[model samples]
Target: MRLAPGADLPVEVLERPDFPVNRGALCGKGRSAPALLARDVRLTGPLLRDRPGGPLRSAGWPEALDRVAAGLARVRAEHGPDAVGVFGGGGLTNEKAYLLGKFARVVLGTANIDYNGRFCMSSAAAAHRRAFGLDRGLPFPLADVPHTGCLILVGGNPAETMPPAIRYLRELRENGGKLIVVDPRRTRTAELADLHLQPRPGGDLALALGLLHLVIADGLVDQAFVAERTSGFERAREAAMAHWPDRVERITGVPAHRLREAAGLFGRAATGMVLTARGPEQQSKGTDTVGAWIDLCLATGKAGRPYSGYGCLTGQGNGQGGREHGQKADQLPGYRSIEDPAAREHVAAVWGVPAGSLPGPGKSAYELLDGLGRPGGVRALLLAGSNPAVSAPNAGHVTERLRALDLLVVADLVLSETARLADVVLPVTQWAEETGTTTNLEGRVILRRRAVDPPEGVRSELWVLRELAARLGVPDGFPADGFPVEAERVFDELRRASAGGDADYAGIDYARIAAEDGVFWPCPAPDHPGTPRLFLDRFATPDGRARFAAVTHRPAGEEPDAAYPLYLTTGRVLAQYQSGAQTRRVAELNSAAPGPYVELHPRLAARLGIADGEPVAVTSRRGRAVAPARVTEAIRPDTVFMPFHWAGAGRANSLTNPALDPVSRMPEFKLCAVRVEPLRSQQAGAEPAGADAGAQSAGSDTVGVDAAGSQPPGADAAGSEQAREETAA
Candidate 1:
C-alpha cells in the first residue's frame, strides 16, 4: 500500500499493482482501514484499574505493566501456573502469535493457550488432516480457481466477505465453468451461481452425502483414481449409499431433482473444486461435515490435480498462519501436534528447554472461556487482538466469565468490548506502524512492511511481551537471544522451531518474502522456490494416498424444536467485519449497516406477525436478542439470519449455542434453534435495536452497551467463596 504525504494519517491506502492475490484491487474493509487510525477512535495510552470491577484510569506504561505482571504472577502463585490463560486472535501477525504461545508455555509455564481461529476454520483443518495427512487452508494458489471446470462453493459468500475474490469466479464462469452454491440463504455470491441449493441450516452433511450418492448411482465415480490413489472408500461409499436421494431430501430441504442436477453438473466437469467456509465449519458436526464434502471430491476425482481439490476459504486475515505457528491449543509451530513426543522434543531443542518441561494441550476457546473463574479453572487471563465479548458463541455467558476473572489484561488499538473488562488495557501499535508477516489462506507467507511510526504512547506487542517476560523473570530468553523485542528476531526463532514440521518455514525469511511477493510453506531449504500446488503427485500421508472419512449425517447440536421453532444462523455483511470491534468504529461502514437487524424470510415473518423494520426478539435457551426485522425471501423460511458484529440488544451471539465439536472443538456458531417475537415497545425510538458504535466514542471503562438484558445469559454464581479466598492467599 502506498502512503500519501502531508496527511496526519496515511489515509491513502493504495492497492499495490504488484500483488497477485487482488491485482490492484481491495475490498471495502481494506479501503476503509484508515478510519481506524483516527486519534479519537484509537487508544493512545495504557489504562489500569486498582481493583476488580473498578473504573479504569490512565496510567503510565511502567505502572500498567507492573500491575499486569504482578496480578498474573499473584494468580499463578496461589492457584498454579495453569490458572493463567492466554487468548490469541486470528488477525495477529505470525510473529505475535508465535511469541504469544511461547510466552504462555515458557514464561508463564501454562498450557492454557488458544485463539479465536478456533471459531474460524478449525473444523476444516481437522478434516484436512484426517484425509490428506496435513492441514493447509488451500493446497494450491488461489490463481487456479479461475481455471477449474466446475466449483462447488459451500457455505461461503465471497461477494461480501472477500469481494476481490469475485474476479476469479467471474473468470471461471466466462471460461464455461459451472458454479454451484450451497447455503441456507440466496446470498450475493449465490446470485452468481449456475445452481443455488438452499438447504436448511446445518444440513450440508446430508446434502453432500446425497450428491455423492448420485455420483455413485450415475457412474460418475472415478474408478481409476479411487483404485490407485485412495483408501477407505468402501466404508465411505457405504455411508453415502445409505442416504439415498429420497432420504437426503427428507433430511435436507433440497429437492431430489435438484440434488441430481447439482451432482451431474459437478460430476460431468473434467475438473472440479469444492471450497467451504464457516457456514459448514462452525457446526457441532463440522469435522464430519467437511469430511462428507471431501468424500464427494474424491468420488468424482476432483482432487490431487491441477485445478481440482477441496479447500477451506479461511475467514480471518492471518488465520492460516495463526494456527500454523503455534497459537492453537493442540499445535506447536509448523502445525506439529503438541501431544507428540517427537514434535515436543524438536520444538523444545529449538527453545533451549527440556522437552518434558512443556505442558500438555489446554482447553479450546469456548471451553476455556466457559471454565473461567469456576472450580479448577483459569483465574487470570491475558487476551490480545480479539474481541470475544461480541464474537464468541453464547457471548453473554462469555462476558460474565470475563467479569468473574481475578485479573483480566487486554491488548488492543481501540477499547474493544473485551478490553472494557480488563484490569489492565495496553494500547498496541496498528498494522501501518507494525512490521510483521502473515500467511494468507493459500498458505503463502507474505511480508507486511511498516509504513509509519506509531504515535507516542502506542507500543508493539513484541515489546509488550518482552517487557512482561522480563518482569516474570525470563528476561534474556531461554536461548539468550529469546524474548527479543524485534519482529524479525521473533520470526527468526519461529523459522528454526518450525524447521522440519509439516508447515515448515526454515527457508522463508523476510527478505525472501519481499523478493518473491510471497513464499508458500514447506520451503525447507534456502534454494527451494516453493510448492505452489500440493498433492499433485502424492498426498502427504506416509503411504502417499488420501484417506476417506466414513462420515454420515447427524443432527445439529440444538435442532429446532417446538419451543424454538426456527433455525438462527449468523454471518457477515459487506459493511462489517467480525465482532465489529474495529469496522464498527468507522462512520462510512456503519452508515451502510447502521446497526444489527434480523434477516428472516417473508414466510416466517408473516407467520410471526412481524413486518419489515419492526423490532423483534430472537430468543433461545441461552439468551434473547432484539433487532429490527428484515423480511425477505432471500433466506430459507426455516432459518433466520443475524450478523454477530454488533453488541447491545442486537448481539446475535447472545442467542447462539456453545456446543463444541468433539474433534475440532469448534463452537456451533453457524446453526442454532431460536424463536422470534415482535417487540412493539422497542419498535419506535424506544432504545434502538443496537448501539451506534461509530457515534459512540469508546473509553476503557465503557461496557459498550447494556449488552445482554439485566444480566448476561447463563451468568451463574462463580466459584465458591473458598476458591476466591484461596486465590487471594
Candidate 2:
C-alpha cells in the first residue's frame, strides 16, 4: 500500500495483495474509501442547535459536551434512566461496541441500548441457535468453497454486493462444483450460477421446502447421518412433506422442474454447502425461511462435516462481531444472553459491578426507535455509527418520530440525513483513521491498521464516551486518563470480559492476530490454536446432536393486494453501500450511481407507460418515493427493486414495510406491497430525487402521480398510526 498527498488530504493507493480473504482485490467501495476522507462533507467539529428549528452552529468540544450532558441529564431527571436511550451501529469496532454497552448501563443506568446490527443477521442468528445451538455465520472459510462439490446461494448477490467473495464462488465452479442461486432478481451473481431459481419475493420459505421435498422423494437423504448426528427428523419431514411440488409451485413462482434440479445438485454432491443472505432473511418469517434451508442441509448430511454446511453471508463491516458482543439488546459480551443469571454475573464481575446492577434486556432495534417520544417511551437518544433516519423501514415515519424527540445526539464522520435532524452532531474517527478488530464472514478476526490521522476537531468514539461519562457524574467510574483511547488497551479489557462466553476471544490479542493473518473465536487459552471450522465431531447441543426445526412456509407480513398490486423488494447497487452516507459523497461513486432508481421489468414499465430513465413513483401503504425507471429483464415482472441508499423522495425505505419478524424482530425489508405510477414529463422533478435532497417543494406531504392522484384522505396518518401500533406490540 502507498499513500500520496491528494486534494483534501493524503489518499491511500493500491492495497497489498498478499492479504488472504480479499487478496488485494479492492471493490468499488474499498478503493473509494479514501474518497470519503474529503473535508467539505465531513463534520470537522461539533455542531449544536440550541432550539428546535434553529440553525446548527459550530461549537468547541467543551461547550458541545456540556450541552449534550445537560440535555441528557434533564431528560433522565424528568422521565427516568431509561428515558435516555443509546443507539449504536454495526460498523463499530469490538472495543467501541463493548464500551458503548458499558456507557449505557454503568454510566447512564439505562436499559435502552441496541444497534442497527439487529436488522442485519438476527433472523439467521435465531435460526442458527435453534438448530446448531450456536451462530457463527459461516462454520468454514472462503478457502473451502472451491473444495465443495456444490454451493447453493439463497437470497444473496455477492458479485455486486461483495466483489471479493465472488472469487470463491467462481473457484467453486472451476473445481467442478455446481452453483444454484435463489433470488427474485437475476443478479450478477445469479448470472454466474449453473442454475438460477427466481422465486417470488417473500417466497423463499416455500422454495426451500419444495427443494427438501424433492430431496426426500428422490431418496437423497443421508439416512445414517440424520439418524446419528441429528434429531427431530420426523417432524421436519412432515412439515416439508406438506409442501408438495404443485403446492410449492403455486406459492413460489419457481417451476417444479427447477426445484428438482436444485435439489438433485445439492443432494448428490459428496460435500456441499447452503449459504443465505439478507434476501430471504429480512421478512417476518425469516427465521423459519432460514431454518428450512438449514434443515435441507441437515437432512442431506451436508452440514457439520468438512467442506459441507450452512452459512450466512453477513453484510456490514463488523456485523459478525458487532452482534457477538454487547450492543445487542438481549446479548452481553461474547454472545451471552443478558437474561442468563450466570452470564450476567460473569460480565458484571468483569465490569467491576454487582450482577444485580445490570439492567435486563431492552427492546430490539426497530422497537427501540419506534418507542421514541411515545407515552412512557425514550426521550433523549445518543446515536453512534447508525443512521436509521434513512436506513430504517418506513423511514418517513421514523424520521417523524426522531423529530419528536426531546434531544437527539449523533456521532458520525459525516452529516448524514439522521445527523441533519440531531440536536448535536459529533465528528468521530472511521475505518482507515482508526485501529480496530472486525470478524469477517468466515468468523476470522482480523485487525484493521490505521493509515492516516483524522482531521482536526475529529475524535475517536472511545474519547467521546470517556468525556460524556465524566460529565454525567461518572468521573470516578471513568477517569479520563484511566479510560484508554488506544484500541489495544480496550481490546485487553474486552478479552477479559469475553473469557468464558460463547464467542470467547480471551487468548487472542492484537499481536497474535497480526502474526497469524487472523484467529478464529473461542480461542480460550494462549497456546490453544483457534478453531477454523465448527461441528466436525459433535454439535454444540448438550446431547452433541443438531436439532431440526419443524418449519412451514408462510406469506410475507405485507403481501401484494389489489390496491398495491406489485411486490416491492429493496437491495444494494454496485456503486453504493448501505445508507450512502459515505459512499454518496465520493465523487467517483456518486458519478456512477448518482441517485436511486426503480428497477422493474420492461413489460411492467411498458404497461405503466414508463420508459427507461423516466421518472416513476412507487407507493406502499406507508409512504411513497419517486426515482428514475430502470427497465430491465433481469428482475421478475411482478416485483420492483429499489436500493435503500438515498434519502428524501429517492429514499426506497420510505415505501418499505415495517412488519417485524416475531422471532428476530427484523423488519420485512426484503418484500412489501407497492404500486408503481409513471410521472408526466413536466412533473418529473415534482418530488425530491437525489441524495440528501428535501421533500416536495409543493409542501404537500402526500406523494402520488398527479395532484388528483394523491393518497386517500387520512391514509398517511392511518399508516403512521398502524406502524407505531405494530412496533409497540
Candidate 3:
C-alpha cells in the first residue's frame, strides 16, 4: 500500500502485514509497481484504426466500442462465432477472467478462447489431473516447505522470479532440511542449495527418470504405500529400469554419481517433495516430463502426505485462478471439463443460457494464434492482458499473424508490442485502480483492494465488456446490478458457478476473504472452513488412489543440427517480468537490466570468434535475433542463453521454436537450436532483423513446418462476408 501527502506529491509503498501469503514481503517487481501508475506511460484513451495498415487516432469511448463491437459482430455473422478468437492473459483478476470466458461463450458464442496461462502451467495441470484428478500449484500451503525434510527445486529460480517465496527455501535449510536445486545455470536459488544438479536444457525428463531408476534400484521405493495408495507402479518401475544412471548421465550431461546422491537424499528423507517450474513445463514433451516427476513422488510415497508432494511454481500472479475459470479452451468455471454435461449445465444455468448454446472445445493458445488469417480459421481476435508478440514462441511469426488479422482488438494498460499492431486499443485500469480477487500459487484466494482512482479516460474491462455486449444486440446479457463493473458482484456469480466442480469456491465471498486475509478453495459451504491442505488422507481421484504414468525421455523438438549447431534457451532476468510491457516502463527496473544479451560459455564464444559485449547474430530455422554476446562460464559450452523480455531485434523469442507439447499444447520455449555468427560487415548489420523465415522456399505455396515438426498449410485470405454469411445461415 502507498500513502500520498497530496495529489501532486510522491507516494510511499509499504508492505501489508495483513496479507497472509506475502507476509509483509514485497519483491523487486512489487516494489516498483507504483512507478507504472505514471499517467504519461499509461494508456488513458482508446485508439482506433480506420483500416488495416492505417494510422491510429484517438476516438471517443462510444465510437471505439461501436467499431470493435461491429467488427467482431460482422465476423461472427459471416463466418460463425468460431471465426473470432478470444485471447486473455494470466494476470487478469478472477472476475475479469470469468467474465472474459462468459463473454466468449455466452455473448460471442465462440469456443476459440484461451489465455497465455497455457504456456505457464498446462503441463503441470495435465499431469496433476492424470494422477490426482485435480490440479492446484501446491496441494499444501507454502509454509510447509520449511517443515519438509528434503526439497528438490526443479527448473525454478525463485530467488529472482519470486523473492518472497525464497524465504521458505532459506528457512528449510536453517531448519536442517536438505535443498537440491536442478537448473542449467547456477541461479541465486541454486547457490543456496546443499546439492545443485545442472542438467542440460530440456533434459529434465531424463534426469528425473534416472533419479527414479536409482531410487528403485536402491530399494528406496515404499512398497506398502504404493500397494495401498497408488496404481501402475509396476509399469512405471519397469519403464525406469531401462533408464540406468549412466544412460541418463549421457543424455542429461549430469554425472552418474551425482544423480545417485541426489536420489538417495530425496528417497531417504522422512518428508520429501519435488517442485517444478517453467523450465520443465514449457517443453514439447512438457506433460510427460511433469508426469515422470510425479511418478517419482508416487513411487517414493512422498505425495498425498503432509509436507510432501509434487507441485508446480506458477509463473503469473493469478495464473492458477485464470486457468480454473472458463478462459481456457478445454475448461469451464471451477476447473470443470468443457465437454462434461453436468459442468456445462451448472455453468450455463448460472448465466441464464441454454447448455446447448455453448460451442464445443476449440484450439489451444498457440493453435489459436497460428490459425489467425487462414482460410477456415479465425479472422478476428480480441486480446486482453497478454503480449504474445514478444513473449510467444516463434514471436516473429506471431507478429506476422497479428498484422494479417482483419480486426485486431487489444485491451491493455500500455501500448505493448501486441497492442502496437492492434486495429483498436482499449485503455484499461491497473491493479491499484481496481478491486478484485486473485488466486496465488498455493491456491490461496487473496483480495486486491483499490488504493486510488484510475485516470479519467480509463475504465475496467467489466464495463467495456458490458457496453460492447449491449452494442452487439445482447443488451440483457450482462446484469444491470453489476454489469457496469463491480468486483464483488461479479465474484458472487463466480461462487455459484463453481459450486460442485474441481475448484469449488461456492462458500467463498468478498466478506469472507477480507476477514480471513486469504482462504484456500474447495470451500463448498459457508459453514465449512476453507481447506488449507489437500490429499492428507486421500487423493481427489474417483478411487482415492494416485496413478503413475509410464514416461520416457525424448529429444527436444529442435535438436542441434549441422546448420543450427548450438542450443538456445530463454528465461527472465531479475528486474524484468515475462514481456517487459510494464516493467520496462519503470526507470529503476530499466536501469537494472537495460536490454537483452546472449549468454554463452567462454569456449563457445571463442570458437565463434565473438568477444564479450560484441554483437552476435543468432539464426534459427524459424527466424533470427541479434544481441550482444555475454561470455560466461556458468552456461554449458554447447548452449546459449537469452532473456525473453525485450522486443524487436533483441527479442529472444524471435528465434525460438513453437513446437507444441502433444497434450499440453505448450510451445517449447525453454530450448531450441540456432547458429551464431559474429557481425563482420555493414551488409550483415543491415540484414532483416529478427525476421521470420517460414519453412518454405521463395515463391512456394506449400505449408511450412510448425513447432511440432509437422507441415501445416500456408496462410489464405478469409472468406468473403457474403459467402461466410451464407454458411452461417
lDDT scores of the candidates, listed in order: 0.85, 0.84, 0.84
What's the lDDT for residue 593 in model 2?
A: 82
lDDT of 3 by residue, 1-729 (tens): 352211222555666776656679988788878776766556767777765665555667999998999999999998988999999999999999999999999989999999999989999999999999889999989989999999999989999999988989999999999999999988889899999998889899999999999999999999999999999998999899989999999999999999999999999999989999999999999999999999989988999899999999999999999999989999999998999999999999999999999988989999999889888778999999999988888887887787788899999987676776788889898888888999998898988887677777788998898898888777865645542247787888999999999899999987898898878998898988998888988999999999999998899998998988888988988999998888876767877887788999999988888999998877887777777899988888988999988775677888888899999999999999888888663243344443632211111121123344532110111112112212221
Indicate whether candidate 1 or candidate 3 has the larger lDDT: 1
TM-score each candidate. Answer: 0.93, 0.93, 0.93
lDDT of 2 by residue, 226-330 (tens): 999999999999999999998999999888988888899999999999999999999999999999999999999999999999999998988999888889989
- Model 3, 45: alpha-carbon shift in Å? 0.5
**Model 1: what TM-score?**
0.93
Residue pair clashes in candidate 1: none
Best by lDDT: 1
Question: Which residue segments of model 3 deviate by more than 4 Å?
Answer: 1-12, 479-485, 681-729
Backbone clashes counted, model 2: 0
